[model samples]
Target: MHIKRVFDVVVVSLAAVVWLPAVAGGALLVLLTSGRPVFYRSNRLVGSGDPTKVVKFRTMVKNADRLVNRDTVPVTNTRFLNIAPDSPLYTRAGRLLERCGLTEIPQLVHVLSGKMTIVGNRPLPTNVMNALLDEYSYAGDRFLTAAGLTGPAQLVGRDALTDSERLRIEGAYCHAVLDGYRLRLDFSILLRTVLIVAHLKPSLSYTEVMDLIARNSGSRSVVALDEHASPRAADNTEVA
Candidate 1:
């Protein structure tokens, strides 16, 4: 919608104006403490299309991605779910950045550039997206909207929820947008996002989340994927 786009640009531009100084300070801190490469660039697919480089403040040791074995680790609330607290992969400065979410400040550039919105589904890396598609039938529906810096899923549970629960929340969000996009709804989510960033508990409850998932699960537009299927075989399964 025109209003949504206008809202995104206006709100995000104003936010950039307010947060740019913090971004600058954060960058300088990363450089002085960690040395060079103040930002980390990642290829993320906001939708089902080609990947785009998403920038964020570097919050790990140099080449940390290359060193971590993601498949063997446990998921956590932090951005780097696989990197444990004691892991040598985290730089001293990076830990502080992660705690305060300073690492994500650079994504303001994404919001200003129209590559992302202030509120929407979180963008997924290519491999992670593909893996989700393999596991859940409704997973692809998340790509229906531009990815957000924060969203319903993030406010609802984030890394604390299981994979199935996450996909369900995302599917409900996609269904909500498809039904009718609303400025008020976006504003509500944005407010909740601010609270979450402030380290406050969200008002959303487990019952509410499950209710949304149950309501949308049987919708003709959203299909459920087999949780157990391998990537190769998942493509062949019929949508239910």
Candidate 2:
């Protein structure tokens, strides 16, 4: 875990060249294309922590959450949520940022500040997470580690997974964090995330991804994951 934090610091430091320009350019785009409030701040529950004001470029209308969103599709078998690759409410600048993956550049601040990590589970909207927990109380296992920019769940887009599968993978990540975290696993997830952002397929199939996780699942089982019983843990502290 300590080493993972060190790695984050080192990597974020080296990426300053790209980070500075990207963040400035991203913020400028939002301001020029969209109106005021170039940044979006929302209280989100990340890992086992309290609600935090997560930062990102504003991607929707000023009052998007207050309006009914028509672009989201419900997650299969879960009465709790709707997710989508694109939303009708997204502003033009927002869509461009999302496409370029610059919408989250501000979040790098959290990573540098030790409030978040480069790879881990994502923070959930209060309503969405509440609805999820209302259905499956065990989903809380996700709080076991720090919130991530991307992780196993992100490797497979949301629509491709069922609610159970999502929960299972999330819990698996948490389990890995507690006992299975490894540097190699962290880089593997990072690489996979890059592939996805580039709109390229990962060299590993879904089964292979799951298998790699299982192989690294350490003995320090802290949570109950998997639809069957035990889950595959992270070989390294994957999302911390």
Candidate 3:
């Protein structure tokens, strides 16, 4: 457990050489194409806890968050404030930064400060968290550990996943953390995140990622039953 912190520091520090310059370049792009405010701090939830101040590159136009809600985006994304990658809300610079994952560059600071992590469940925007808590009784438990920059959910992405499946994968990761965290497990997720972002490897399917988590979870209780084992026609059930 303690070692994970050390690992986070080491991984983030080594990446800083490039991350600093990349963030700078990204910020310049935002300034040139959009305007002021290179970064913004959001009150994202980290588990079933109070909102933590998380820093992110400003990828949207001014007053963008105020304009969107769970059901208000011009597109059909039902999660994360219902904003899709192609939402018209994003500035020209915003689209590029988001596509490359550079929008989260400032979060590396929180990882170093122990406020966030390198691997765990991804933090939820307040709108998504509130909706989940209202609809799913066990939604809060999806946060067993602190929020991370990338984790099981990010490994598979939001498009290919049903919201229920995404929640289950997050719950499974929390279950593992509640059981015990393995350094090797977190490392693998982090490595896969970089590879996928770099387009070096294709994103894993939910089943494939679940298998990876189950294998390194170091517990018999970490089983994620295959959702595809039997198809139910609209009578679907979510994992707890």
Which has the greatest lDDT?
A: 3
User: Which pairs clash (backbone N, Cα, C closer than 3 Å) in model 2?
Assistant: 120-148, 176-234, 180-235, 180-236, 181-236, 181-237, 182-236, 182-237
Model 1 scores worst on lDDT over the 10 consecutive residues at 222-231
Candidate 2 residue lDDT tens string, 1-240: 898898789878998999889889888988898878999898888867679989988888898866642224443455335535487788999888887778787898999999988888888777677666666667788778898777787777666655556777777777886786777777778877788788786545445556656665562452334435432332121121
Best-fitting candidate, scored by TM-score: 3
Stretches off by above 4 angstroms in model 2 are: 68-80, 203-206, 216-224, 227-240
Once fitted onto the true fold, the runs of candidate 3 whose alpha carbons sit more than 4 angstroms away are: 71-82, 224-240
How do the residues 64-119 of candidate 1 rate in per-residue lDDT, one tens digit apiece?
86766334433332222334555677788888877776677778788878888777
Q: What's the alpha carbon RMSD for model 2?
A: 6.0
Q: What are the clash counts of all predictions, listed in order?
A: 2, 8, 0
TM-scores of all predicted structures: 0.79, 0.84, 0.88
User: Which portions of model 1 show Cα errors greater than 4 Å?
Assistant: 69-87, 209-240
Order the candidates by TM-score, highest first — what do you get? 3, 2, 1
Once model 3 is optimally superposed onto the true structure by TM-score, how far is the C-alpha of residue 169 displaced, in angstroms? 0.6
| Candidate 2, residue 161: lDDT | 59
Candidate 3's displacement at residue 64, Å, is: 0.9
Sort by lDDT, top down from the best: 3, 2, 1
